[model samples]
Target: MSDIIRRDPRAEWIARNRLHPLHAAMQPAQHSWMGPNGVIRKNVHGVGFIGPNGIKRIDRSGAQQGGATKRTAAVEVQLPLHQVPSPAFYINVVPDMVGGRLSSHDRDLLGLARQLAGSDGAVLAVVFGEHKESAFATAGVDRLLVLEGHEFDGYSPEQRVQGLRAVDQQFNPRHWLLPDSRSGGGELGRRFAASLKERPATRVWQIKGEECIGRAGAGQQDLARPLPRLILAAAECADPISDTRHEVLPVALSTALARSLPRIEDLGAVAVDPAAIPMAEAEFIFSGGNGVKDWALFHQTAAALGATEGASRVAVDDGFMARDRQVGASGTWVTARVYVAVGISGAIQHLQGIGACDKVVAINLDPGCDMIKRADLSVIGESAAILQALIDAVQTYRSGAKRDAA
Candidate 1:
């Protein structure tokens, strides 16, 4: 019989070797001007806001007239380089589709870029097509890079990455910024940083340095060399104060390249797993928000409706709901057959991901809230009352159907 309790000599050696810790004193601690965890410590001199218009949208209305053009291609006519600053901060717009309608996530992306641009950084706002002219105009970004597209050519990730690489190689920015959404923008931004061998940061609420990382190959042998990449995801953080009201900004890429250079082990690209988003199969979904005023009532409402309950990040953050059910840009992006927003103010970041539902019912006391405007059916009332009524209505309908069947 085999010795069941005895371990092999090789197994014992492997386990012991794994447990051996590296010498603490030999490894130098990383130093930063900001706090240990703070990513932004240096003053940003230049920034880049690059938008890759790889896909172009043709005017379907003029399809018969052969007036077809790519949407992403229109970047050329919109943002001329001379209009931009010597080393302007760049902002790129990434387009998205939700629920058969164009989503407003790109607006949020522009908003983030605009906020970054408002600092002492020259802003270069890039657009894919004429669609974003108004968005940039409203955001008040003056300089633009608008690249025109071929009629059939659409947004390509590799192409955008190359365009960004070209600009960064020349300008060398201090801070590179982009949205953290799924539709190619986030991927391209990070890939550009990796291709440039700079630290690629994402979900970044804020940044101030050009330090990035790049990788050549896999495994210990490859890591033995000086790896040149740093990818950051910057979606989670408390709000920070931004002062863009007074100062004229510098170029994003140029300043980043000039400053914020740190000596450290080359941190590889922060890998982001493709979000395995599960589509909501339910016909009706009940979602609550911080505005519910009563967390218990929110749960009661969901239970009463026999509907799955979902909460906004605020509710989840405050311990009202499980983090698993939180819905927003940083949370689960859900698409249900029917979606009901309860006591939720439809913020652009939150609404962009969910607007794809076939039917939307909003229950809120605030008639002025944007959710009311976007909902297919808006019930201007308290969530508790509205939820109770809905539950009752559903129960009654079920009973009637059962009776008819009998």
Candidate 2:
């Protein structure tokens, strides 16, 4: 063999495509690099290679490299902590806390509150019952008040409003902010405003100096009004706080809250067929594509998972699915919490449609497909096999639960 250097285009392409299985092996070794100060910095984790003596050896000259080397530690970036020792006033925020965590809407509401709070005022987050969220500080909350009790759990908007009223009495916040979403925030905000006799700016999307802008009358016209004491903000109202962290200091109401008689009874969620739900409003979607050879298995899996069915343009055009079941930029723009794409090659239009989805799980035989590149999790296999595995796992889990109940 000649001792000449050569470049392999295949290796270069694999290195660039992160979704390729061989991408990791194609990465160049980064043991040392010139620092910003012009000094050579050595990666401690990438120090030495295993020598012939079956021991680790170090060669600063770069000959004895790549042996017994461990992966470099990922650097954790910490934002600056923002503290308010004493606040002149408060900007209280009531978040939906969907699924016991702060959703994107909640973060947007908190961001709006942060802007309203400014320097002298504190951003106070008022949460109902218990929550699993742990990023209140980073979400721009200067103070947190949790109203914990069974009364605040489930569908208890009346109790939630009472708690908010209690917060109003104690804090007398400069402004109150809530997400005007279908997930309870809109109703709760309206009720709270009615209770306080405050005319709130509803569906507000933007807030300038002294005026607020919102959608009104079937969302066909924009309504501008003077910034009010209460606001029901729409989604994407303002960017979420990312630059700085807040104190998240714990606060409490001065007096015990007065409980209001419940007008609504708490009933657990009712199971409904995913087919009846609209694609745009569906929280979980299982979409199929041309690669899906077994349509029956695809439908079975969707039904078992209680997920709304969607299809790529190819599937819809081929008459495997209805036109309304299509999902993409050309079809319905879905903002599902979890979108499962089976055998879909992920056309640009399809990817664009699910842009706002929180998570995308792709099952495809081709690991290098665009769907795999965009997926948060990817399973490289026949879709039928993967669907069967998922169904079996779910059945096993349910059987165990039934046995435990007995």
Candidate 3:
């Protein structure tokens, strides 16, 4: 037996090394085995060593008793700075009703500033209302120029132009980004461009590097080129990235300069229609077409659903809805969360306006219509009946929810 065992390489090696039985146990075994000490052990493929009690489980209570350890420090992301050819300025025109808070479009202007200036270049923001340093800092604005005095309180077109002129004379920014919005931004941009004797590219939707792209003329041709001295960017163009913070240099306005500026007669506050909400700002839009009858009931149903009323070009042309409420290529573009089209035939122009809508619901008598095809959900029925049913269902759900909450 000794001669035969000595001849075997495995037994000879084990004998020569004088290895312990526990050392052999540590090797990957097929299954669990009891050792000399009556301890059952196993070497699992993925799992670490399992003791006699089986796989050791982490005890939550024990861990809680031990308390938490210190967390690792956050790693900072370093971005390379770019050198801009010239300074860029953002014009922030505030309305009194806004309570000094920056609008979404205003924030977009800041985003544009960051895009233009990058990490090193200075980005200036010129505002007419109350200046919030923290807000501009969060927006990555390098400098803040607040226009003070009663003349800058409201949306006075002439007063705003004078304020913009003051900033222009001081900085002489090569690129000026203005909001291309319904809240007097478009009008202001046009007037500013005319005053400066520079053609402003309006409704600009994209800014790649130093170039700006947007729709131009009645045909709405795609216009893309090196950014002009002035640009009126649409709200959808630059999404606000509030991730970075910057130290903003505050600039003091000269009281003498502000006083000496030509002042135009303040057109007293214009009355606002409570029922009318701009399509761009509306969260939910209920649009009607020529196929919709009982226009009054249609509008009432919209009000019941807490949706802003919109209209197809045909409906507006037929005098069923106001021209301002028209949703099409020639009309205001809406980026609502939900858009309900009642009796709308889904013209290409009409569909273009609702392109940004998250969910589209179409109620049309024609099953083969484009609206039905494009809609997330389509209901084939009479427009009037469908709208009334939707209104009733929504009201019932609301009442039920309220009762449950109570």
Candidate 4:
């Protein structure tokens, strides 16, 4: 039409018209083409494309591309039914002036009872004073049997044994769980086990499956009995899982039975130092090691800090401290809020005991020792010199506090 001339304009138009159906048939339904670098490009409907080298990769699904998918069905686990002992008893005899409240040790025994007796099984808690039903119910006990009287005011070994015997005869429980407390539970449990001619595992700390394990001598041991008749559990062994709403059962004691129990002679009690709290229950502990030479200064520092005294195995073996005060794998394990290790060359056994401590402060001659490395704060120095300085600092602080108060 302008400068260009078409020799076959009519023929070209005719050819295009004829080829239209053929081009349509040759083309694919879904569009796909090769990229410039020989990579294949695909449309939205295509799952993947074949590369030039014959490698295939899938495209990201909607779920993987930041879109939420419908949640899958939950899978249910099948739990085996454990057959629990029927009519299990958790006996607790409160001490005089304790207001009939359950101690931590007593609560542990009740917890073991609840664990042994599943949700459906009957777990009865027996007490010898007037107590709130909510207390036992909060500990997951199914029932409470309270025997309240003036005669049951004070704790007596003889009275406890008699009451336990009477209750045993009445209920005839298959299993009896008692607290292995030094106050009175240990004695009661031993005597009861002896009367029944059954050997009980004392101070049990772990109950896995059907086997009960605890510290024995210098190490741990397990007792696997098909059915345990009686168990004296440690306070650290079990924790309470309260879920049951308990029923209160008040058992009235006959005057004859109550009076038949012999009265214990009241002896004046001696006051114990607050710092003499057991290592297991101590909030703060000041421990001495073999390198400590000035024992007097060490003790003075402990007193100033209101800390319980503890010793390493080497110190105990050398007669620097009592064997009972030794803290280690071969000794008593302690759980404290703060533990101060003075002059201790950290051994593996010693570390095991203080493993539960919240904050550990180590003062040793060598900073490369295990205790210093594991400690939250480390002070490298002679033990005796450090102890004296600490004592003096504490005294100055106390004097300043008193002055401020005045």
Compared with the true structure, what per-residue lDDT tens digits does model 3 show for residues 266-345?
A: 66777544257788778688899978987877977887877888999999899888899998778988877689999998
Worst 10 residues of 3 by lDDT: 44-53
TM-score-better candidate, 2 vs 3: 2
Is candidate 1 or 2 superior in lDDT? 2
Question: Which residue pairs clash within candidate 3?
Answer: none
The TM-scores of all predictions, comma-separated, are 0.36, 0.80, 0.48, 0.45
- Highest-scoring model, lDDT: 2
lDDT of 1 by residue, 139-222 (tens): 334454543343102445555555566555654444455555565556766776767776544444433433322222331121
lDDT of 3 at 126: 72
**Model 3 off-target regions past 4 Å?**
1-99, 131-134, 217-220, 258-264, 276-406
Q: Tell me the whole-model lDDT of each prediction, alpha carbons only.
A: 0.50, 0.85, 0.68, 0.66
Determine which window of 10 residues in candidate 1 has minimal summed lDDT.
219-228
| Residue runs of model 2 more than 4 Å from their true location after superposition | 1-73
Please state the error at residue 399 of candidate 2 in Å. Answer: 2.1
Ranking by lDDT: 2, 3, 4, 1
Q: Model 2: per-residue lDDT, tens digit, 279-368?
A: 999989999999999999999999889899999999999999999999988999887888999999988789878876778999999888
